[model samples]
Structures are given as C-alpha cells and as structure tokens.
Target chain A: MRAALYQAAGDVTVGDVPDAALAEPTDAVVRVLRSCICGSDLWSYRGVINRPAGSRLGHEFIGVVEEIGAAVTTLRAGDLVVAPFQWSDNTCPACRDGVQTRCDNGGTFGAPGTDGGQGEAVRVPQADGTLVVVPGGPDGVDEKLYPALLALSDVAGTGLHGAVLAGVAEGATVAVIGDGAVGLCAVLGARQVLGAERVVLMSRHDDRAALGRAFGATDVVAERGEAGIEAVRELTGGRGVRHVVEAVGTPEAWDMALGMARVGGTIGAVGVPHTTPQLGLFPPFRQHLTISLGVAPVRRYLPDLIDRVLAGSLDPGPVFDLELPLEQVADGYAAMSERRSIKTMLAG
Target chain B: MRAALYQAAGDVTVGDVPDAALAEPTDAVVRVLRSCICGSDLWSYRGVINRPAGSRLGHEFIGVVEEIGAAVTTLRAGDLVVAPFQWSDNTCPACRDGVQTRCDNGGTFGAPGTDGGQGEAVRVPQADGTLVVVPGGPDGVDEKLYPALLALSDVAGTGLHGAVLAGVAEGATVAVIGDGAVGLCAVLGARQVLGAERVVLMSRHDDRAALGRAFGATDVVAERGEAGIEAVRELTGGRGVRHVVEAVGTPEAWDMALGMARVGGTIGAVGVPHTTPQLGLFPPFRQHLTISLGVAPVRRYLPDLIDRVLAGSLDPGPVFDLELPLEQVADGYAAMSERRSIKTMLAG
Candidate 1:
C-alpha cells in the first residue's frame, strides 16, 4: 500500500508501506475513499512541530471496510464508514461522559505505529466504537457527497464541538475567530444547529469570507488585532458577542477572542494551539469568563453531523479547493502549506 | 460616626468619619448590625494589593434600614436587610443575566466615596437591588443568627457561585481547594445545595478541616503541594474529581486545582488572586479543562442562601471565631490578619 509519510522539515512524500490487515479481534481494515489535509498538519510541514521522519501523517478519512475481525459486530466488510480523528473504546468513563477524545483506550490515527488515514488502507482498533457506518453503502450514496462525508471525520464535527462548548444557545450572538474550514463549519453549526441569532466571522481573505457568509455568518470583519476586536464589538452594539469560537490558535487570535467576549460570556477554542505557551488568567478571571477548550471529541458528534450532511442541509465539500490522486499526495501538502488551497482532498 | 479605615499597610483603625446620609434617589441609609472580615481583605492589609491610605474598609454586612431616599421603593425605615459586597441596579443587562458584579452601574461598598460595611451606618446605593430584605425585622430575628445572615453577604454566596459554575450535579464528586470561610461554604454548597455524592476538602489547618467536615466534607486531605494533589487523586480512586472549587488563587493553589481535576473536568475559582501573573495554557488545554472564574456576583445568590440560613439548614456563623464591638474594630482586623481567627465580626 502507498501512504503519506513525513520525510523531514518542509518535506512529505507518497511511499510504499506495509499492507494494513485485521491485527486484533477488535480491528477492521478500511480502504480509504477520501482524506484531506488539516490546518494542524501545517505545523509539521512548516517545521513548527517536530515529527519523526518517515512517520505516517493524517487523521481524517471516509472509507469502505475491506475486512473485519471476529469481534467487530457493528460493522462488516464492504460497509461505508467514517473514522473520527481519534479512536475510542466508547464505553470508557470519559467516552460515556461525551469526551471521547480522552477515552481510556483511545489514540489518534497518525501515531508512530498506527495506520494513517491518508493512506490506501487503515487498521482501525476498537472497530465497533470507532467507526460510524454511512446510512447507505458506497454504491447507495452520491459520489459528489464523498467530500462532505469525509469532512464529518474531523472538521465539521470539530466545529460543532466548539459551538457546543461555547454554550451557543438559541438566539445567541457568536463571533468565530478564524475563517478556515473549521471556522466556517463553526459558523454553520452555531447558526443552524445551535440556533444562534447572529454570527460574525473574522476573516481578512475575501475567498474564505465568502464561504463563511454562505455557511451562515451574518457579519464579517476583515480587521486583525485591536481593530478586529473593535469591529466585532461594533457589530454587537458594543456589548461584544456572548459566545466566541476560537478556531485559530495564534496568540493574536486568542487575544481577539478574549477581547470580543462580553462579560460573563464563554469562549470555545478548537484550534490546535502551537505558538501560544502561556495564557494570562487575570483578564478572563476579572471579566467572569468561561473558557472551554481542547482537542474536539469528534466521534461524539459524528452520528448527528453525518445525518445532517446526508439530508442535504449542510454542504461542507467546497472547503476542499484542491483535490489530487493518492500518487500526488505531496502536491496536496504543498498546496495547503503555501496557502494556495483552503484545504486539499486526496482520492484513493 | 465611626468607621474602619485603611491607614497604611498592616494598619486598620476605627475613627470618626462623615455621618451616613442618602446621596442618590435610589439610596438608603442602614444602621450596621453585623459586618465581618473577609480573606481578600488581607490582600490590602499585607500590601499585596495597593489601597489608598484612609480608604474605607469592609464590604459585607447585615443592617437595619435607618432611612430611605424618595425613590427607594423596595425598602423602608426599620427594615432588616443584608447588602451584597457590590451594589448593583439589577435592571442592567448584566444583572438580568445573573452577573450583578458586572452590572453597568455597580460598585463595591468600600470604594472611596461609598460607605463601608464596617461603619456604624452605611449609605447604600441602589437600595432596591443591593439589599435583600430579611423576612423579619432586626428585633424579630434572633441575635444568634446575625453572623450566619452576614455570611450571606459574601462568602456563602460566593461559595454557591463556585459550585454552580463548576456544574455540580446530583451524584457528582467535588473537591474544594481551600478551607477558609468561602471554601468551607463551598463544601457545604456542593454537598447540601448541589447534592454531590462526595465532597473532599484540601486543608492543612486542623481547625478549618474540622469545620469543613462538619460542613459535609466526606474526606479531608491535610497535605499541601504535590502531596495534596496525590491525596485528592487517591480519594477519587485515581481518576480525580469531576468538579473542583479553587477557593485559593495563588499559583500553587491553581496548580493543585488543575492537578486534582479529572480529564474533561471543570474548575470554578472564586479566590482573589494576588500573586499569580499568568497560567500555562498547554496543560489545561491538553486536558480538556474548562475554567470559569471571577469575583462572585453575591447578590445573585443572596436570596436562596438567606432562605437556607433562616430555615436552619445552614450555619456559617461559626466561621466568625472572633467578635468585637464597634470601638474595638482595630483589634478585629489584627486578629484576622494574624490568623488567630477564621474571620472576625464587628458589632455596632
């Protein structure tokens, strides 16, 4: 099988890897149909975060079960399924509490020994708990919806997690502090699923801003830093938004999220923070702020998000501005790293 | 009239000051019946936080209404009432949202021109919203309950706010990180009001720990630092508590609170942090932690706490281990500053 591997700093390549197979009684072999690059992947590509040379790289995928072990009861061979970014044994205390990302026996797909999603096949552990079968098998669904279904594996579900953590209640006014795929999805989730009355997207790029508008952002602010905060305040009648989704983890983005929240408001941060080391507590403490942040427990949100996508209410596929065959996986990484594409989707 | 004044660092005195009088249409003059020293007061007394010399001291009291301005519709002369530490109009958006501490026109009792609760008489602003009337007048209630009722002004209410923010629920396990009046009250609130299945108190002082146990702490860990965190984890079968109340705000205390929480847990902090400058975000961010903190909106919880006190379901008066007459106000401050008393109550 061929898979994407991290060769070194500023380097990624498609290379032959050992074939994936059912390695345990609870494992299933998945032949990936679609996969994409995440903003977090840029961390390793830019040499900002260290990754072991020749390690497998990606964590999002929608695929068909090629083989199932004896213990896999919920899924069988040839079934279409989506794998959450992290695999969890859903019955653990953490998983039962809706924080599957912290499940006792859970691990992300791209770890050193694990099978990466950006590959020909993946050996999924805890198959019964980790895979959510698409309502219709591969042949029953439209090929055009594959990209959106693949999104359910990570980005869309992550955005919904941010909205849920932010306490985006009915009639809330929210500010999304990033215009990436996840940020646009947050805008959609806050307005469509959470019933937020208004959503403001902070984006300087016209292309991303346009997508955010289509995803339900009622207002857009192109300013950054202090001016961005001021713009968000102005949009909210000077009271600031009651809920803020921090989809960009930069220090400036974090500061903007803090400044744009009203007193007693909440901030939900889903971005994988790479640059920020310490966050001052005094400011948020004095303002009575509630900050809930972490890696999104995407598996917990997969079922509902899949239903929404299959029902045609959500169209997140457009986020994949560039698509390439598995042989050209290196180009997919380059496009996203150079900012030429909002996201890159690879077909296997 | 005599009132407690901050003469300088480590110095507090009772001296003659201007007589209390109604200054605004919403104001009311109250004859102080009971006022107590708070843990936060030590911040200024120790010079950890600067305060202007000769400023009024104290912000928690229960009193008898002496006079009311023309527009004071909800209060009357001779009515017994308890004033929250901060006065708020209650009609503002913040107040309506149950965050009276951030009310548009709210101000603390000890601010320069305002009357301090430690004085013989206090001119309270926003009378209708700042003061919650006791069902019975001063003479109609027992003098023995004065101290308990006074606790509702700040500590007890603040503790309840912590429990609420931590999302304490039926069958939940809670850990309280301080054993001062507020921490003790948090133990009581978590077990009594929030119905937690287990309550753990982290305290080194035997006296405070005993009170904590009486207040419904199922377990007491007298260890400090890493030992304290270890003890708490062991108490919860090594999973840590789902809810933590950070009643002490030093960096060490914050670290203990963070260490004592289970993954995906919440920490509700009510302590007035004086030494901690910044908190490392990576630790909590990776742990999927939610932190909600601020000065308590005591007014929001006053009514319910008062009901609990009046019904004999709560007895926080014991926290006031030292009591003195109005003439001995300086002695009261000295006792609390020297840690000879958990709290001090002053009589008019």
Candidate 2:
C-alpha cells in the first residue's frame, strides 16, 4: 500500500509501505478514505520535531473497516468510521472520566508499530473502543461531509476540548490566541456550544482572519507581542477576557494567553508546546488564574462532534482550503509548510 | 504602642513604635487583641525571605476598632473585627469577584508604611472593606475563640481557597499535600465544606499527623517524593485522587500535588512559591490536569469560615500550640523558628 513517509527534513514522499493487517485480537485494518496535514505535522516536516528516517507521519483519518480481528465486536468490515488521534480503551478509568488521551494502554497513532493516518490503509488497535462508527455506512454518506467527519477525529474535537476546559459559558468574553484551523474551530465551539457572548481571535493573515470571522470570532487583533496584548486590552475595555483558548504552543502565545485572561479567569491550552516555559508563581497567583493545559482527549469528544456534524449544525469543511489525491501528499505538505493553505485534505 | 520588627535575618524584636492612627480618609485604627506567627513568617526568621532593617512583621490578627477615619462607614470604634492577611477594598472589580487580594490599591499587612498585624494597634487602610466585624462587638466573644479567629485571617481561609479552587465535590477523594497549619485546615475544609468522601494528609511529623487526624484526615501518607506518590496510588487503587490541595510552596510539593491528581482532576495551590518552577507542557497535557496556583483571597472566605467557627463546628485553635504576650513577640518567632511550636499566638 502507498503511504506518506518522512525521509528527512523538507523531504517526504508517497511510497509503497507494508500492507495494513490486524496484529492483535482487538485490532482492525482500515482502508483510509480521507487524511490531512496538521499544523503539528509541520513541526517534524520543518525539522523542528525530530523524525527518524522513513517514519510514517499522520494521526488523523476517517476510513472504512477493511478487516477485523477475532476480538473486534462493535465494528464490522465495510463500516464507515472515524478514529481519534490516539487509540484508547474507552473502559479505562481515565477514559470513563472523559480523558481517553490518558487511557492506561492507549497511545498516539504514529508510535512504533502503530499505523499512521496519512496512508491508503492502516491498522487500528482497540477497535471497539477507539473507532467511532458513522450512522450511515460508506454508501449513504455525502462526499462533502468527509472533511467535517475527518475533523471530528482531531481538529474539531481539540477545539471543543479547549472550550470545555476553559469552562466557557453563557455571557463570557473569550479570546482565541491563534488563527489556525483549531483556533478558528475554538471560536465556533465557544459561540455555538459554550454560548460565549463574544469571541476575539488574534490573526495576522487576512485569509485566516476571514475564516476566523466566519467561524464566529466577534473581533480580530492583528498585532503580535506587547502590541497584541495592548490591542486585546483595548478591545476588552482595559481588563482582559474571562476565558482564553491558546491554540498555538509557542511560549509567546502562552504568555499572550495568560495576559489575555482577567483576574480569577482561566486559560485552556490545547497547542502542542514546542518550547519549555517557566510559569511565574507570583503573576498567576496575583491574577488568580487557572491554567488547563494538554493535548485534547479527542476520542472523548469525537462522538458528540460527529453528531453535531451530521446534524448539520456545524460545517468545518472549509478549514480544508486545499484538496488533492493521495499521491500528491508531498505537495500538500509543501503548501501547508509554506503557509499557503490553512490545511490540506487528501483523498486516499 | 509596640510592634514586632525584623531587626535582621535571625532576630525579631518588639519595641515602642509610632502610635496607630488613621492616615487616610478610609482608614481605621485597630487595637489588636490577638495576633499569631505564621508559617510564612518563619521564612524571614530563618533568613529564607530577606527583611530590611526594622521591617514590621506579621500579617494575621483579630482586633477591636479603636478609631475610624472620616470615610470609614461600615466599621466604628469599639467594634471587634478580623482583618485578612492583606487589606483590600471589597468594592474593586477583583474584590467584587471574590478575589480581594487583587483589589486595586490593596496590599499585604507588613508592606512598607502599613501597620503590621503583630502590634498592639494597627492603622488599617480601606477600613470598611478590609475588616469583617465580629458579631456583638468584643464583649461577648470568648478568649478561647481568639486563636480560631486569628486562623481565619490566613491559614483556614487559605485552605478553603484551595478546596474552592479545586472545585471539591461530594464523593471526591482529596489529598492535602502538606502537614502545616494551612494543610490541616485544608483537610478540614475538604471534609466540612467541600463534602470530600476521603481526605489524605501527607505528614512527616508525628504531632502534625495526630493533628491531621483530629482535623478529619481520613488517611496519612508519611512518605515523601516517589514513595509518597506510590503510597497515594496504593490508597486509591493505583489511580490518584480526584483533587489535591497544595499547601507547600516548594517545587517538590507542587510536583507531588500534580502527581497525586487523577486524570481530569485539579490541584489547587495556596503556597507562595519561592523558586521558579518549569511546568512541562506535555506532562500536564497528557494527564489532563488543571492547576490553580495562587495565594488565598482571605477576606473573601472569612465570613463563611467565621460562621463555621462561631457555630462550634470547626476549630483551628489547636494549630496555635503556644501563647505569649505581645511584649515577648520575639519568643513567638524563636519558638516557631526552632520548631518548638507549630504556631504561636501573641496576646495584645
């Protein structure tokens, strides 16, 4: 089967890889229907996050079950499904508490011996607990809904995670610190699900600014650094917002997220931080701030998001600004790495 | 009037100082009836926290209003009151939100030019906002209630703050990560107010362990560091507790607090951290933890704690194991610094 492999920094290609097969009794083989390039994927593609030679490189996919091992019960062959970024046993204590990312025996898709998402066929572990079956089998689903369904696997779920962690509620003034697809989705999550009264998105690009506004951002701050802080303060009438969603993992973004929150407020961060940052005890204490940081429990949120997408209340399809065939995966990476596309969806 | 002053790193002296008088329109002079040495106060006595020459020491007191400035409306002469560690205008936005420590124009008791709590009298700023009036004036209150009232100013309130921030709910398993007066108070707060099903206290001192049990600790973990983590895991069936109260400010205590919390659990810290602690983004993210770090907004929790105290349901008086007159305030410092007493109460 052909799959994308990270050969080295600035080099990736679609090449023949091992065929996907069930390696465990609880596993299932999935023929990938749709896959995408993530902002996080750029970390390794740009040589920021080290990747060994010929490493499989994706953790988001929606697919059809090609085959299942003896122990797989809830799913069958040819079933349409979405797999969360990480495979988790939903019955674990952590999973029961809605933190499946911390499941006792779960791990990310690209770990050694696990299947990466950006491929024609992949193996899924703990299939019954990790895969969410779409209501309509492969036959009845609309082609246009692929992007939205694929988003529930990680992107949209992550944004919703940030919103939930921040405790966003009615009558809240929220700030989203990044303008990426996840950040834009956070604006949607805040306004649509959490009932935030107002949401401000910090965006430098005109394209993303438009997307952010479309995603329900009430305002956008274009400046960065101290100027950006001042801009947010100005918008908030000298005080900062009561809730902030940090969608970018840079230290500067973390600082801005903290700066954007008012006293007794919260900042929920979902970005994969690339830098080591020191949290100042005195400043956060003085502000009475609470910081909820981590990766999204994607599996925990995927079911609800899938329902939301199928219900036609949410349309995150536009986040994929570029689309191409699976063989053009390298071009997709280049487009995203060069910031020419917000995200790229590949038809596998 | 006499006030305790930190003469140097290891020396504190009580000597004649300027008479307590109202210096602002909103100020009030308090005739301090009871003051106590705090765990935080020992930081200076042990030379851990540097003190300038003759810096007024102490920040926990209960007193009677001796005189009032022109604008002091809610309090009057002869009224008994309990002042929080920090004085704040309850009318500020931050104060209105129940975080009075962040009140605009408010500060700690021993700050330069402010009257310290360990004195015969104190000139309080924002008199109406900073002082909580004791019912029936100073006449009906018994001397036995003095130490309990003093605890409201800092220790008990701080513990309550940790519980409140952690959002402790009924049936929750809680771990209080210190054996200090504040940690003991946290155990009480978790049981009495937060409805925690089980409360664990990490204590090394036999005396404090006994006090912890008396204060409602369901279990005691005497181990520290990795062993402490293992002990807590054992108590909770290999999973950590749902909530943690961090009363120790050191990085080790903070780490333990984080380590003790289950996935999606919270750790509320009231310790004043002395060292710069680096929060690893990936670890917290993977654990799905929320860390609420800060000093307690003492004034905000005082009224409820005061009610609890007056009802005879909660007593923090045992924490003050030694009593001394105001003139021998130096002995109070010596006893606490040498670990001869858990805390010292000074009679004014």
Candidate 2 chain A minimal-lDDT segment of 10 residues:
A274-283
Using TM-score as the measure, which candidate wins?
1
Best by lDDT: 1
Clashing pairs in 1: none
Error of 1 at B162 (Å): 1.1
Question: TM-score for the first chain of model 2?
Answer: 0.98
What TM-score does each model's chain B reach against the true chain B? 0.98, 0.98
Models 1 onward score TM values of 0.98, 0.96
> For model 1, how does the per-residue alpha-carbon lDDT over A192-244 read when each residue is reduced to its tens digit?
88899999999989999998998899999999999999999998888888899
lDDT of 1 by residue, B1-348 (tens): 999999888889889999999889999999999998888888888888899999998999999999999999999899999999999999998899889999999999888899898989999999998999998888788999999999889988888788888889988899999898999989888988889989999988999999999889999999988999999999888988899999988898899999999999999998867665577777777888899988899999888888888899888787888899977887877888887889899998
State the lDDT of candidate 2 residue by residue for B1-348, as single tens digits. Answer: 899998987789988899988889999999999999998888888888788889898899999999999998898799989999999999989899888888986899988888899999999999899999988778888878989999999998898889877878887889999888899989888888778889999999999999989988999999999899989989999889888998887889978987878888898988877775666666677677898977799998888888888888889888899999988988888888888888899996
What TM value does model 1 have?
0.98
lDDT of 2: 0.88
